[model samples]
Target chain A: MRARVLVRPKAGILDPQGQAVERALPALGFDGVRNVHVGRLIELDVEDASQLPEMCEKLLANPLIEDYEIVQ
Target chain B: MRFPGSCDDVDALLAAEMVGEAEILWHGEHNLRGVDAIVVPGGFSYGDYLRPGAIARFSPVMESVMAFAREGGPVLGICNGFQILCEAGMLPGALLTNVSLQFVCRQVTVEATGASSAFTGGFAAGARLSIPVKHTTGRFYAPAAELDRLEQAGQVVLRYAPGENPNGSLRDIAGVCNETGTVMGLMPHPEHAVDPLTGSTDGLKLFQALRDHVGSLLAA
Candidate 1:
């Protein structure tokens, strides 16, 4: 079995990298990019698909600063 | 010291151990008996891969460190050590990359957070100390409510002085202690500031505070 996790900085938390990209978009001849947020994707191969949440909680994502969505 | 890679100041620490200023023990969990305290020094542990301090949190030695913290033993984490503590869930908040996304290395002034803890006992309220910090990912972050709780509980023990927030830490926080006040994690390197040759001796008070705390325990 395989699982994929999408991790993102929580809302209201500062995302400097995302903000930098958003700021540069207008200068590069692009516009209307609002609320830009940066995140990461992690892929894993596992024996049991049900254990992904626990894995996400334990190591893949830090609950204090990030949120993770697990996909099968 | 048992980690696959050691800090740049390993020789300096060994020098401290040699002079009997500090009785450094290099043992893992099984031999942790009678260990008075644990100092997780600064360094690029685990190559800073997958973000700073993330992979090192799973190291075998941390299990012992966690047990020590649970028992109210004094544990000080500096720089990379601080990152490990946050990753291991031993401390609140997380360290993100600097707002400028550049590595910061220099001497900065930190103010005492008025929180009473074994680590900050040597300083007076509102006292400021000079400490050196070297890190790429040293910005601290926590939710607003949790930040309020930390303040209410006096867990915040240190903060960068105004105009010296080197890494965009929330509330200018430079260091924090756990609820019980035994475990502390900070980005500044006190060990590096112990001698005048390094510029200032302001960081010595931190070690003195730890010594006093441990001494009192032994006297009791």
Candidate 2:
């Protein structure tokens, strides 16, 4: 089975990279974006799908700093 | 000790040797070789492929380092080592990208919060040291509750002086130690400040404190 883990800075955590992109978009004629947050996507193949969250808890995501949701 | 991509290992080793015998422990090894103290230096370990210090935190050697620190051994992590320690769950809080979103490199003043940690044992409370910091993801982040707890417990060992916060760490925190005060991590490169030729010897005080901590442990 393959799973995707989306890792993001926890809510209220500052996201400078996302803010930089959001600022640039307005300068290039895009607008109306608010509260932009950047994150990473990790796709992996594993033998047991049930262990995806455990994998994220152990390695794929840092619970202290990031939140992860697994998609199958 | 040196990880594969650790560029500051030599400087750390040299600084440690000035106080006592020093060595290079491989990141792939599980043995600490009976060292009294450990220094995880700075660099783009694993090429910083993911978040800084994310991958290197799981190195085989870190298991032993964790065990050593848990047993009250003195361990200091500088820059990337600091990031690795935080990612490894050995320290509270996380380092985020700088608020300015730029790689900052400069000499800054950091004050010792207290003589509570093994690394800060040589300095009196409020003793200020000049050290150079160079990094992008150096802003320390912790939830409000955790931040209050760390402050109350004296786990915050060093803080940037007023107006000297290069990376905008929370409350200007520059270094933090575990509850036992045996393990510590900081963003500034103390190894780079040990020599007068480098324009500051304030860093030597930290190394000396490590040596004294080890000596006291051996004597006990």
Candidate 3:
């Protein structure tokens, strides 16, 4: 099975990368960028989708710094 | 010197003590194959220029670090290392400039948050420790709901004492573990205060815990 894990910093967490992208958007002539929080996208090929939750807990995301979802 | 001089300082300390005694690999040449555990030592790689770990995330070493973590290898990122881990998406959450907007350097009291990870297994639940935190960007922030989930899951590894809240982190959290408790990141320099002559030896337990955990895994 193929799984895509979308990981993002939790709410209220300050995302420096997101902030930087937000700042750059104005220069790119793309305004209305209220807030941008950067995150990670991890693609994996697993033997079984049932292992996704365990994968998320073990490697896909650090629960302390990120939240993640697995799309199978 | 991409980051700050502190990274160099921590590197020197680790080298002097042979913290791991493992072979060191240059940036891209190693792919973390057959590696047991990875240590993101403290250093201002890339000079801490963009953000503490912003630039280093693109470094060659990070490719190996990420791969290692993905394969379930134990990874520990200290101080600036913690910053890099977050940037590399190895850990969650972002560490921002201190809430006070000042670099804090001092010994602070920490309480174990009942985590049972390779890093904290040696300590009893609710163990109190004094470790030195030195950084301007050590404040930890996460959404309130996520913080609640972490607390409920017992993933919080260390929290600052009530009166000794050093960086204004949410719930005074000082360190945390991944859900499985294998990966960990913290702002304090446990490598710095590990020896008895260093004034506080509480940090030794962290390294020892890693060694023990890895040893047990290999034995198993």
Candidate 4:
């Protein structure tokens, strides 16, 4: 199975990288874009589909700071 | 313990030796050779490829270190070591990119908060220690409930002094120990501040605390 995990900084957690991008976009004249958030996309191959959540919970994401969504 | 790309192992070893004997335990080996305690020094382990400590947590030596910590062994982690410990689930919370989005390197003042861990007991509660912090991802975060629980349990061993936090950590936490007090992680480079010529020696008391903890364990 092929898997894609979209890892995002959890709500209420500070996303400095995203803020940087948001600020840069304003500098480039693209305005009115708010709540800019940045995250990571991880693609992987798996033999068992059931293991995706475990993989994200264990390594692909940190539950304390990030949330992961699995796409197959 | 020495992981690949660990730049501070020599300094940590020397710092550890100042209080007692020390050695470098490579990440590849599973056996710990019965070391009294473990010190995971700072560095960019595995090049910090996937979130600083994501790759290095699976090293064979960490299995032993985890087991040792479970057995009430004292384990102190510094800088990148702190990141690794959090990723390994040996400690609570995670270190995040600095709010300033810049690598911070400077002297910081941290107040001891009385976890009584091997790495923190050297100072009394409210005692302030001047140490140097050097890292980009040093901001610490945990759920609000978890933070409250930690504060209640006194697990937050060291908190940056007012206006001294380099990374904007929640509650200004600079260091923390596990519930058992045997495992600890901090962003500050205590080993780097162990000498008088380096502007301060406040870090020596932490190394001395580790030695005392190990000695007590041996005598028991």
Q: Which model scores highest in lDDT? A: 4
Q: Which ten residues in a row have the lowest lDDT in candidate 2 chain B?
A: B114-123
Task: Please write out the lDDT profile of model 3 over residues B1-220, one tens digit for every residue.
Answer: 1233334344424632454555444454545556677667776666776467767676776777777777677888788888887777777676877766678999888888777888889687779888888888888877788789888987789988788887778889888888778889898877777667778877877877887888888898
DockQ score of candidate 1?
A: 0.65
Interface RMSD of 4: 0.8
DockQ values, each candidate: 0.65, 0.75, 0.12, 0.83
Q: Report the Cα RMSD per candidate.
A: 2.2, 1.0, 9.1, 1.1
Score every model by TM-score: 0.92, 0.97, 0.71, 0.97
lDDT, model 2, position B18: 88
Error of 2 at B62 (Å): 0.9
* Best-to-worst ranking by lDDT: 4, 2, 1, 3
Task: Report the TM-score of candidate 4, chain B only.
Answer: 0.98
User: Chain B TM-score, candidate 1?
Assistant: 0.92
Error of 2 at A38 (Å): 0.9
Question: Candidate 1 — which residues are off by over 4 angstroms?
Answer: B5-30
- DockQ score for candidate 3: 0.12
The candidate that achieves the highest DockQ relative to the unseen native structure: 4
- Show model 2 residue runs off by greater than 4 Å: none
